[model samples]
Target: MSDKGLHKTNQNGVSRRGFLGRTGSILGAMALAGQIAPSQAQAATAGAAAAGPIDNGAHVPALVIGTGYGGSVAALRLAQAGVDVHMIEMGMAWDTPGSDGKIFCNTTTPDYRAYWLRTKTKAPLSNFLGFPIDKAVPRYTGILDAEEMGGIIVYQGRGVGGGSLVNGGMAVTPKRANFGAVLPTVNADEMYDTYYPRANAGLGVSLIDPAWFESVDCYQFSRVGRKHAQRAGFPFVFVPDVYDWDYMKQEAAGTVPKSAVAGEILYGNNAGKKSLQQTYIAQAKATGKVTISPLHKVTSVSPASGGGYTVVIDQINTTGDTVGTKTVVADKVFFAAGSVGTSKLLVRLKATGALPNLNNEIGKGWGDNGNVMCGRANHMWDATGKVQASIPCGGIDNWDAGGAFAEVAPLPTGIETYASFYLSITKNPNRAEFSYNASTGGVELNWQTAWKAPSIAMAKTIFDKINSKEGTIYRTDLFGTNKIWGDHLTYHPLGGAVLDKATDNYGRLHGYTGLYVIDGALIPGNTSVNPFVTITALAERNIEKIIATDM
Candidate 1:
């Protein structure tokens, strides 16, 4: 899909001639045309023609603030709806490989491997992913600060794809009831039935390597959890992942690298998972109605007359160096920055009177998964040092497991036939208080940890249940041996700007005409498992709505 007018292609994907034939309407095409090197001949040629109205000019110019899960999906649907969507990404446009601030590898072609080589961010995108806090980039885009969380590790990716480039790509839709828990007011049947599947198709969600869980080595860990749960009398289960199994099979066949074989995930699995960059954003660009400008950070957003806005952005250079400042107007604006990022931005805007007409629910109902962590004992042997050898079997709906409960699908390292033990836990309302530090112009999260006690208690109970039921199939080795059960850290932080009728249900600012917020921040409350699929689904749901009605 070149940037030209709607070039009707015989095939499915991008068509060259049709697109390039309509490049006259493109904005600043000549500027980028020459800037692109010969290597980007196709992209450059397509960019020339990738501009024009697709239909009845029904499309309005929309500014999707971030290219993360939500904004990226929004851009795609909006473009499909014939809306002119200008995707504003605050990070680098990963045309090269490396971390946020550093480049490491170079790409040889235009495949996923080549794309990965072009981008430098790593998955398990935690604080460790960037430079140390003291030397870290001044801007606060969701980069983790290991030192700040008592040396806890949390990862976040930057660049055009956002975290999608660095995520494990394990898309698991939360249980229907889980949705029932977080967002009580939203219609679930339509969401799970209509929106969920739509998001799945868009994100390429599916179960991969189902038999892998049954591997002699994999179930070993589940046994360990069983024993621990028995001892304390708790329940646990398995959940499916959204990974593409066919890709993994090819990878395991040696046609691909081991990176696809359950390895390289925590650091940046090069194998099978699909990120937002590869799927939705790329697809959106193909529509020609969507244009993403990366390496530019948003400075502010002001409402424009007739349901539009003016966005101030700081253009950043290829080297992550600030180049200049510019402002772009949009017929509609969306705040898809993740929870911490979006809430901070909105909280500041609300407090500073920038959005003086904001609602009271701007930053309320703040809660994470009531995250709690603990280890179970398996006295059969020593622990394996593998970062993530096995994924979770699923989760438990004990009605006692916080809002939910689940355990890792145990996998034994080939070296140790004994069942591998795990330390997993979650809570119902691991709340965080969003207090505006007026002088600093930033949002401070003072966590209101009410679920702490219940989380820890549930962890212990689950461990006891596993032990009494499954028995010790293996010995245990804790990550931090110094601590006991239920003593790990949380990475699945959720809910800063919760969703409800108060916020217009779909995350539109209650009183605002065109401003919308999408991201993890809009999570109804919390999910028992990782929230990527849920997040992306909600984004898919909302973005489609925006395209159908608002845009």
Candidate 2:
């Protein structure tokens, strides 16, 4: 079997101890943490859930901003090392079900729970069949945040589990050969050998049952995608995902509540998918040393008068109103609020004199992960299934030849439109920077919409060839009138406070004693695939070193 095909099979589940047994004792201890099961994930809120808003002036040994992949990893490792860790999440805990008795809304039918503090939903695919699909909803602190930067709408998950709540559970690890380009300063051997397997196991990453996938009605779209890609001489590969293959099979067999098949990705999946809330965050909470405060946003982090950092937080309501303010101190701070959030905060903090000694590279390397989207109008004879799986299982590997890896995404609109949709990750060299605007007293990213041109051209290399081979054309009505590319948004926002530039090689911010960045911000730009697993693995690597030395 080839290197890329290692995760292509899950005859028995990926073992958490398989790789750790070869590594040192530190990683061996880390490997003991297991992926929370579906039933356990649903019932865990009763036990290791987030505590209510943290009290004013509380002090913690380690404070982690954001509860995403990196933050969850940091909080878990720090707590396991016997450090009292406090995680502040700017979004809701999402433990409570909504009026629909589900924690999340459906992709096709977004409600007030769809967007963060927005009166209307800001879906990625805004148009369908020459008609706009967005509709207004009551303003609430919803799951997804369509943050409008200078030239791109960064679609981020705004809840306790972070992007895990809103993304297709494609838990991918970049091929070994591409590791250097992804993080040049890091040791690839350790990552690929120790951390990647640990992350895959921790995330509960597994391959789809090939036998089941070929027979299931929900994955007929992916099968069709594979056929088209292979026909066009592209390497079609089965991608591992965090969604439970067993639960998904049950969903297909009508034995369990539907999630991926019912189009439950863009919001959140109530079943099957193993989000951070089920994996890392759940483990973090299991350590009694870790406590999370949801609906709390950190505004400032500066050196305290005596020692550590003084943190200012705002507790907000569902309507986005600031309900209370709290001041706390932390001996160490981990900035894991993702790329945009961490970069924005750090840039503003440096500019506004909160952390004046922060290095000039605070928000330097920012990129969109070369995210581009397009759909192909398949022939009526090749009818993609109406019941499409929300989680993409296959991708066309044109990254080596065309600099684009296109995931055959789903357009689960409940009817067959004969459309083959794709979300391509391209190798666009364009990088943006985030800077604080003094006039507006806000942070801004200097990313022009034109920066996506290289991405579109790279994506075209794959789709254009596939179109020619299949006698199909690009769908014009999906993004907008005559629009072939969805270049206005990015679901994978990366870089900013980049590793080896904005921070040390291991993510320690320069000029600060205990400030660290352990999130996607540490990755300069792209990771060649869905970046969560990389982020989680990097966090695991970094925190292990910190716990070994700093602690």
Candidate 3:
């Protein structure tokens, strides 16, 4: 078979000794370090499950909405401080395996299990050679949710892990200088020295073993990406990830079930990736002071006449039906439902008189993190390898001059497509505002599809350079035939209820004593990298202060 076809098939000549030699030692070390065992993890979850549902006007001391990085951190820290915390999630629990014995559907074969409430799949790379590449899928509550707004498609994860369930696992911390600029009011010294490190450790962020990366078949695409970037006079940096290196090595060696190598990210990683569900959420459950209610979507948050918040939630079923409406009275409420989710809820509440005192900055200062995805048509000699891994390990950092950090993303089509794709986080200063629509009883984001022009222009500063150096041209087939950039969507939506403006410096809402705005909503606009690590560190910093004083 050709090399392209060879890579499509499973690696041959695997042996038990070879597998154990590479992975066993690493697993042993991890186990020796008192990592939570499977049974212990299950026991912790059972303890949290033992807490009964908070339906029918049940009251709790603290209620966290959404289970993303911010909510997970808040829940864990609050629980660890001996506070009873309850989390409400709109997504389903992803721990249980389906009838196919998998927690998520692979990217190579998307089905009803790949999307959330969509009849048709909406992949980031939507087409090839003028032909639509996405297929029809059943309308079900899947993992990745492509929520449509007025002018942009927001991609978010839906499950216990939230964005962690569907993201690329690229746990990137912004440069200290850039981070300080992003959030000027935040104490840079405290964030860089304390919270960033703390968040990295809590999230299990680690660099790829350089030696292993050099030899791994799955990383050949990244190496090619590095080569082109360096040749074009750009710096290629190794980006840290939340994936376990030992497990990835085992997957490449064909000694274990594959996740990253088997095209697992974007939907979910069935193994190896250390999502928030496995870390903070699990630890919170172990405290036995935190209980999570999945499939519970918080609709409104209004002040109760009794000096607390009244939260109305809809219990959704597997088929996306709102089966029941429930109420919870909480002393505190945290808006951690991500940038879009939180912004939508807040804008509606402010306009509908539920939270009339909310500041005018409720849904202002929103941005797409300057997200732009593009692809380059490389020569046949620049083969990006057929064995491309889904979890990206490196990126081209032209942020200093070009205002863009471009990840050498994988085109894990299970075949050699002879294309190089990149997802760039640029420094686009364009901001959108979410306004309440009185007619539709919904929120509208006043961001035109054309607003992505600046982001696309910023990204071209890097790709255009490389393309010129390599004598290559942009690929129109990847995103859509004749379409050079996928700029109508954002995977990293930041801002809306920004820190210090919409809330206090510590994430507390201006008018509400007990309400907080955590998650990506606190970011002013852009993080210049993947927003999760920054979101996490900011949460760590804010929650630490909140626990010490507010609680």
Candidate 4:
């Protein structure tokens, strides 16, 4: 569909055209300035590859390690450019339905299918009023992964879609100024003019009808959040998403299968969500030059005596046990295993002499994107509605003064929690390093849980204003035993191998010619918004350059 077709009048007589007119103009100016011709933009979505089974020891021209945003974009673009590619994902495919005929487990009734390789559920919000709300479940390879480091619990999605399978689907582009600050070496003109639009279009991003947002039962929580934010004299902006807005409207009206309205995010969305498996990965598979090996984890990568790299992989089962080991040679390798995964692999490889030429900057500049979660105890009159959607649509933007963008997150327990929850992204300068532990032969992040203090301080600037304006207080029962802040975990981990320092300008690693780092690890710490859009755009920009010159 064209951009004009995306603007339709809602039932309340509000035209989405008027709501998004300014946004459209920005995109238009970008297109004009960049001179992004029709063919170039169309080329972004031109190819579809049918994935075939991976031959155990076969050699390929390109190998992408990870199926997240970076890996998917690399695989698709490389395959479209006629470089045959193979992808390795460490998680389940997630497209198969269970015996109950559901593709995913809902948040309200989390079972063994809710977690990855864990016996007990390790929810980000693990307690209510000092009591543990988590339960034991059978250990299996599930969708959400709460990976534990020394002092932090990093939440990530462990499936073919990576974080897309379990995130709230907020597709936000960073402010232009913020983007420049986050990645100084990147050409800001190219990103804003060409790559951002290309990434957004390819991801199928859409905005909710403002009229429906005002009237829908599922968005009552967001409305309350907007009301409180505005009362505090803060800006509340609607966030675009990769979800099907029309299908969400049908879900609200009971005319279709309910996923967002039925508390089905975080665990996984059964419908209406455009995860990578449904978008980039699917398109890559249709190209006939790309293949994915789910449940296959890359263990080592070493330079081959005969010009390529030898990649050691382990095919694991549902119980987290390695069933078979295989090695393959690739002429080129791309690391897209997310920030933590890629960082761990690189740090281990460097320390263990597998790739000792990798610079000391390989494991530095790791951050949590300044994540902090808090809730407000609302008054009796401030009912947040009984039917709440798990997908968030709006946020309080106080980035200028407090350096925080507070999302009105969902409390989709299928009940009236009467609390206003938020997950704020702040500008924190704190970063940690990943070091290899020789004794245990593992990589460890030197980040402490207490390092989130700066982020908490920044987030409080926004919520404190809202609390004072609404005459409310912080909720002390959501995160832990009277813990007001959920500072022990991070949902957005970014930057380990930074762009300019660890790699050349276009994600080409300094020590290696055919190796690249194209994921969130390329960004330096934070993007001041959700990291996915920036990750996608950067991958788009880098891959275009790679295809033109390096390939």
By TM-score, the best candidate is: 2
> Taking the tens digit of each residue's C-alpha lDDT, what string does model 4 give over 1-551?
01221121112211121010000000000000011111322221211112433566789999999999999999999999999999988887765555456767667666756778787777777766456667776677777888999888888888787877767878888877676788999988888778877778777777778999989899888899999999998878888877778778888889888887777776787888877876788789899888888888999999998988999998877768887899899999999999999999999999999899999899999999988888898998888987887788888888878889888887876667688989999998899999999999999999998899999999999988889988999988767667899888788889999998999888988888899999999998898888888899899999999999988
Q: Against the true structure, what is every candidate's RMSD?
A: 10.9, 7.3, 8.7, 9.7
Query: Model 3, 56: alpha-carbon shift in Å?
Result: 1.6
Best by lDDT: 2
Model with the higher lDDT, candidate 1 or 3 = 3
Could you tell me which 10 consecutive residues in candidate 4 have the lowest summed lDDT? 21-30
| Clashing residue pairs, backbone N/CA/C < 3 A, model 3 | none
Q: Which stretches of candidate 3 lie over 4 Å from their true place?
A: 1-52
Candidate 2 lDDT by residue in tens digits, 265-321: 777777777778777877888888888888889999999998999999998877788
TM of each candidate vs. truth: 0.73, 0.93, 0.91, 0.91
Task: Compute the lDDT for candidate 1.
Answer: 0.50
Q: What lDDT score is found at residue 274 in candidate 1? A: 54
Question: What TM-score would candidate 1 get against the native?
Answer: 0.73
Q: lDDT of each prediction vs. the true structure? A: 0.50, 0.81, 0.79, 0.79
lDDT of 4 at 67: 90
TM-score of 3: 0.91
Q: For model 2, how many clashes?
A: 0
- Per-residue lDDT for 1-551 in model 1, tens only? 01111111112212111010000000000000001122243322222212321221133478777888888888888888878787766654534322221121111111212121132222121121122111112122222211122222233455566666544454556556556776677788877777666666776655434466454342444544444444454444444443445555554455654332333332233334455655787799889778776656777777755447766777654334566777666778888876656777777777877777877777766654555543444454534333223334344434443333554433322334333334343555446556688787666766533446666666555555555565542223232234443333344545667777336777787777888887888874476556666777788777767666775
lDDT of 3: 0.79
